[model samples]
Target chain A: MNKPGNLIGWLRKKLNGISRLWIVECLLLLAFGAVGARLVYLHAGPNEVRIQKAQDASEFTKSLVPFRGRILDGSRNPNILAISLGVHDICANPQMLTAATNTELAVSILSAYLKMSKEDVRYKLRFSDKKFAYVKRFVTRDISERLWTQITNNHIKGIYLEEATLRSYPQNNQACHVVGFVNNAGVGSLGVEMTLNSSLTGTAGVVKGMRDGKKHEIYTRRTEEIQPIQGDDVILTLDQQIQYFTEKALDDAMAQHSARAAWAVVQRCRTGEILAMASRPAFNLNEYGAETDMSRMTNRVLSVVYEPGSTLKPVTLALAFTEGLVTPETMFDCENGSWFYMGRILRDYHPYSRLSVADIIKKSSNIGTAKIALMMGDEKLHKGLRAFGFGRKQGVELPYEEYGILPRLEKWSGLSCSRIAIGQGIAVTALQMAGMMSAIANDGFLLKPYVVKSIASSDGKPRFTAEPVVLGRPIDSKVAALMRYLLARVTEEGGTGTRARVEGFKVAGKTGTAQKPVPGGYSETAYMASFAGFLPADKPEITIVVVVEEPQPYHTGGVVAAPVFAQIAEQTVRYLNLEPTEPVEGAPGAAAPAP
Target chain B: MARVNRKKNTADQQIIPPRLILTVLTVIGVGMGYLGIRSRCEQLGSEIKKLESSCEINQRRLENEESKWAGLMTPRSIEEALTRHGLNLTWPRRGQVVRIYDSRANDLALVDMKDAVRFAELERVALNE
Candidate 1:
């Protein structure tokens, strides 16, 4: 305000000094601007590189996604014994949650939905300075949706959801032993699940996205993603209908006989395919946690071994006939129903004064069968048993199959040989008995019993198909036919297995009444009654074995096991629509064929 | 020379201002928001697909259970299952049976058979008796 030209002389001096000071200030401001620009360039250069590295890290993590597969049945029906369903893993940052209003309320609400304790939830929310912490795992879709709604309505912050898989079993207990179950991490635990786990569990997928300072997804900076590849499907050879029937039957028998346990198997003789197999006291696959006992988990049809009893007599008779040591007409004196052989008094159920080889089998005479075994000797008997698929595993694909006990010839005593001849000393599994019976039904050709028919990939292409493997043909076709004739007579009126006679079909079968061994000798009260047979003796098809343990009063094979065989055979014949060759003259044509 | 100077002053007054560049930048900002919305919609679509697949898996598991339950519920399946386990259904015996016969024989014939059936009176019995 002072400088108009008036104080020109004084103003000039002051203006000159101020001008110099202004020039110096101008230079200082330019220097400061240059320094600021340089600092900005330095900071931005490193930040750009850091941002690029972070983007690459996200891309790397996203590439590891894998896909899971499906499970199917023999009919190509989806078994889905275990499956992966989409779920969410919920997480939160406790420190950030502290600022959230009604924090305790939020924790309680989440804990209730997640099935966790409020204290646990609160503790997780309180102690976490880490950017992320798991609040809950395996949250279902419904719960997750409810959580989302809660978040939206309440404006909750610091919550997140991560994709995960939860396994489910559809057919809870149906075919549990066969279909098996999975573990917590979606790993197969048993049966088909364990067998085909590698192909069924899929790879996990990932997505790379920029997260905010709180690790929240940034809408703008999201980038690369990789999708999970789904696993291939496994198709089993189990027939659901047959399996259900088998299980039901076993359950009833176990209850009826007051048996400690029981097992049964149905096999197609020609194909060696196990149609149905069941053991009593089965468990549900869904609630495996309820019963984790090892005994209940076992598939007894393949694992347990017991004396096959009189059911095994047919194999001995067949072997005797095959080796030309005996024929249908060969007679042996049963010594008025009792005989002393190898210091063991073997007795017949009936005092058949004299019995031909065929009659010996029809009456299930222990004395007569022992005589036949003595004639064949131990070497030939052992060879014949081995050839019939006895004393060996059936080579089924399932785990934990037993090779039933068969003492070598060198280990056999005089009494042991005779005892084994009547099916006393040896032990056999239900599956082994079925396989042996299958050999007789299959024209003396023993086959490897297999439950799984085929395994297929997800696309329905068969990865593997089971072919009929002939273990051995122990006897000739003629011998098998002769044995079948002899067995059929056992079911005739007044014969041992009169109870096993079916109405419209000629059933060939043998009965077994094995006394359970006690501390000293045999337990008089406890018995294992079993019946193994094939239908339409002339042209055999299905081979079945039924074993019942500890019947109340009538513990004989003919009394307990034979009746069960008749019932199953009757129903199965009707189920398969097997045409009867010898229909009764006045009987109604079997069951009318299903349309 | 005077005319040229007036023309130059008019030209200076007509020159456009540079402040309009900010309007272009604002348009770009709006475009970025629209793109963000579009990408979010696409992401949601993919998530829906994944969820659909998961639903299918669950449905299949339920179907398997239903089929098993159906099999167990059927009467035939139950009966057959019982038989398989070891319970045998017994047929009616003679004690349980009621036999009804239609009699056509005369009483005289019954009397004659009774008299002839006796051992001691065989020789003494008359035809009338």
Candidate 2:
């Protein structure tokens, strides 16, 4: 403002300042460019790109596949008791479905096809805010296919199929109790199903797909998948054909005897594997709803508890003989058929003048048996019974097995001891009785009974296998053999179990007629008749126990139960194709009186 | 005093370089960007693992259902199904039988139990006459 030279100098200084500012701007831009280039290098580096690509590929390919296990039989044959298939949970986007063409008609058609009511469909469609709602779960393949056709043909919108699983039993009720039944969500409920549920229930897989903002699949750009691990298959010891026959026989017996209930079991004598176990009446596994709660239960040969009657006599005799307190020739006067102890009178079914230790068993004399028990004393008898697996669980591979009642020696009065000696006052289950018989047949060695043979993975590799387990030897083998000989006579010319004779088979068995316990004491009319025996008396194969409760005309074990044993033995021998032995000539007739 | 001032002014006239400042700014910016990118990668990896596990579970469930369906839809089961639905297959009676031939011996015989009985009766009547 003061001079021209001063004004030119100020303008030059301001222009120079603007040029320096531009140079500073250029330096800042260079720094930013280096930083941006470094960032790009870090983000798109080889390591980072490789990791991203691997992750995307894995996510895309791994999610949607599943592998389930198979259920196989003893022969390694697949009997699909339960399995999985591709199915769908029918769902809908309620708002979309409502806005679609022919909404009412679509809902009506879906409801009819799915067996759901149109009202339910309409109610779901009314939920406008709900992005998805399920109409039904676990639709079958046939139904799903039909639905897919219907949706395509009718142009229904928003109805979709999602993958799910459904369990089915092919044999249905054939092996229902053994194979067990699975629930709606594919959980095992009973039998082998529950036992091996963990191995049978394979791991479930998931599907992850790229989705839009509304959670709809957008071409599935990336998916993450993991394959499921299938469960193991269980192999049972049950022979299906044997099981069929056992069930048929039990059903017929139950109907013919007008029995309230009946149960039977056939076990391998050497090995404790149960070949067949049946109870009547039984229900179908597929139609579980149609059965009553009572029929749905598995008896496991342990449902009923009754006095073992004369079947217990052999055990007592075996104990006495083993203790050196009695010999086969040892004789008891039998009090001329009846004896009184502690104001209780015990009588034999037939009067015997005198019976040797062997004859007492052959005749099944109650008085004679009580006399032999008196010699055994309370402690040795109790120990012997306990060792024989009485008053304790037999350790079978089944649930809810009962340990029958055996009162302690201290609890037994003189009368109680005498009564219990002849199989009264003490109650035992049929399984326990059978186990006791099997122990004798197996040379005094008790075995822990089991039904499952092995558990294998879906690839046919064994996961767990069962072996024949010897529990304990309750008596000396010599004593068992002698007892076996005496028992064989019970099916001979003058024995009580004359009716239990099988042709060309040397049968050894005992007959039991236990009076039913009434309100006050015992009933004379009602009886629990039982016959327990091992076939081919010299060398045993199978041991069976047949119990008949309260027959109409005759309630004696020899008359009611022994005949059933004979029939079962004949059939079993024929079916097993067992080598026939020479018949015991002059075997007593079933009509003959007990000797 | 004037000569000393001239030498000091010449020393101050040397220019400062911008490389040091530029290097420092570039390091700070790159470090921050790398951290952000690393965090995004970790997040995606975890999400992918979760999705993978879920997919595995679903796949197993689907396989289990498929085997069950195949088992229930067998030929034997179909025949049983028909029987359950009350459809019975019956054989023709003796009067409807045509003839029987023994394949091994090439011998012709009566097909029906009733016809065999009738032929046996005719033989007995002829012998008696």
The prediction achieving the highest lDDT against the true structure is 1
Task: Report the lDDT tens digits of candidate 1 across residue range B26-129.
Answer: 88888998999889876885687579767865754554455455545544556678899998875432134232223532233233223212321222212110
DockQ of every candidate: 0.02, 0.05
Name the lDDT of candidate 1. 0.73
User: How do the residues B30-110 of candidate 2 rate in per-residue lDDT, one tens digit apiece?
Assistant: 998999877777577657767865785465555545555545554346557889999875433223323222362112221
Residue-level error in angstroms, candidate 2, position B54: 19
Residue-wise C-alpha lDDT for candidate 2, range A259-360, written one tens digit per residue: 555566777776777766666666777666567775556664765678889988988888888888889898889888878777878888898888998889
Candidate 1 docking category?
A: incorrect
Q: Write the per-residue lDDT of candidate 1 for residues A1-595, one digit (tens) a residue.
A: 4766668877677677577778789999999999998888767765787667766554323454454565555543434445555668898978788777878777877887787899888877776576778888877666787887887677778887887766555556767777777777677887777777877776666766665556555544546666665676665555555666666677777777777777778777766777677776677776786886767777888888889888889988988887788889989988998887656688877787788998888888888998899898888888888877778888886778899999888998878767898998899998988888877776777777776666555457767777666676787778878888888898987678888887768888888999998888889899998999888787777787888878776788887877777777776665554555464554444323322
Every candidate's TM-score, chain A alone: 0.82, 0.76
Q: After superposing candidate 1, which stretches have Cα over 4 Å from the reference?
A: A1-60, A63-68, A75-82, A87-164, A202-229, A584-595, B1-129
